[model samples]
Target: MTESFAAARLPVRLTINPRQRQPPSVDLLAWIHRQPEYRPVVRQAGGGGGRPGFSDAVIIAVLAQGLLPGLFNLLQSWVDQQRTEASIRIQTGDTEVELQVSGRTDSARLLAQATEALRAAREPGPDTARELGAGAAREPGADAVD
Candidate 1:
């Protein structure tokens, strides 16, 4: 016998009520909350009438003036931000000797990995820029341009 698994994917449609106040109001939230497309999918995802999975599409539609591309742009911005943060760190060392690595942000996992790499190479260095390689590198002396 063999066992197999399938991933369930659903197309979600979301709509916001225009009659509602332009900025914030009940009619908009209600329209989004009562949209038919999400009901079945939420149920399938183990949510009942009381507890439903708020689909990303619904949230996007509500937040971005119903523009899907806007939602994607926002998400992309966040992703780009994380990647930028993950690259920023200061290094103190000689060109051929040892280097010290230091990052302002306290990401434990990232710090630990940097420490491990430093220890393995027996160098005192912060090679964050070098680690990024040429293609990924931002302009020289540029402070993590957004």
Candidate 2:
């Protein structure tokens, strides 16, 4: 119970949007909550009636290092099981990355892209550093699941 070596966690917003006539974010929230690991951390988009929390955003506390592979893995598995199209917008601070996912999603590739973007957010590259200074979120995806 010491703070000295405790890993710092940042709240990252994950917005799950069903691409077609799939299902609502509530259903997805239940699915994610069913996961033993994510059960405790996953929460509703809006809390105490906040202004911008009106969407399908689910917040997950993340460590600056080891970027929650389980969360991505769970997302890919959900996509496979549902056999539907969806998009997950992962955001922290002013940096963001959107990923289109579906049954045919290349899990590994998306994981790589997300990891790279998050790393950049944590330690921005030359270009990303400038973009951050300019207050722009990263746009590396149109990044479809098809």
Candidate 3:
């Protein structure tokens, strides 16, 4: 018998607006796909039945590996060079978070916050049920406040 299980998918949405006259190009798409953990699907503005001038382009990607600080740093640098206003939204299951990068925003700090958020999501918390059970076993009213 074979059992089917749903695979985890991490969706990352990137919106880029170029400062220059040129919109995002095929080379940029290729560069993103070259990254180890990224599988990118690029869509030009208004090309996928969307409104015109919404953005220069959008890249929706699935992250095959866990979040890495270096990846964010590299993206930040690229956006900085292009003078692009960029926003990245990461969604895993029901949790969604976004980061916006502009000329004045500090990328390192943004990366740190993202790392913390990811860590908190993935790490299990204390077992309150187990703790309560242990206390009850030791004394019937151990946890009761008098």
Enumerate clash totals for all models, in the order shown. 5, 0, 0
Q: What's the CA RMSD for each of the models?
A: 18.1, 6.2, 14.1
- What are the lDDT scores of the predictions, listed in order? 0.26, 0.57, 0.47
Pick the winner on TM-score between candidates 2 and 3.
2
- Which segments of candidate 1 are over 4 A away from where they belong? 1-86, 95-106, 123-146
**C-alpha lDDT (0 to 100) for residue 88 of candidate 3:** 61
Model 3, 15: alpha-carbon shift in Å?
Answer: 7.1
TM-score of each: 0.19, 0.60, 0.51
- Give the runs in model 3 whose Cα sits over 4 Å from its true position: 1-27, 34-53, 64-67, 119-146
lDDT of 2: 0.57
Q: TM-score for model 1? A: 0.19
C-alpha lDDT (0 to 100) for residue 6 of candidate 2:
31
Top candidate, metric TM-score: 2
**Model 1 misses residue 36 by how many Å?**
52
lDDT of 1 by residue, 1-146 (tens): 22111101112132211211123223222333354543332221122222132221222122211222332233223333333211222221311111111122223333333333323333335564344322222323322222
Q: Per-residue lDDT of 14-112 in model 3, one digit per residue for the tens?
A: 443333335644344555555655543443335443235445455555442234344555566666666665656555444345555555546566655
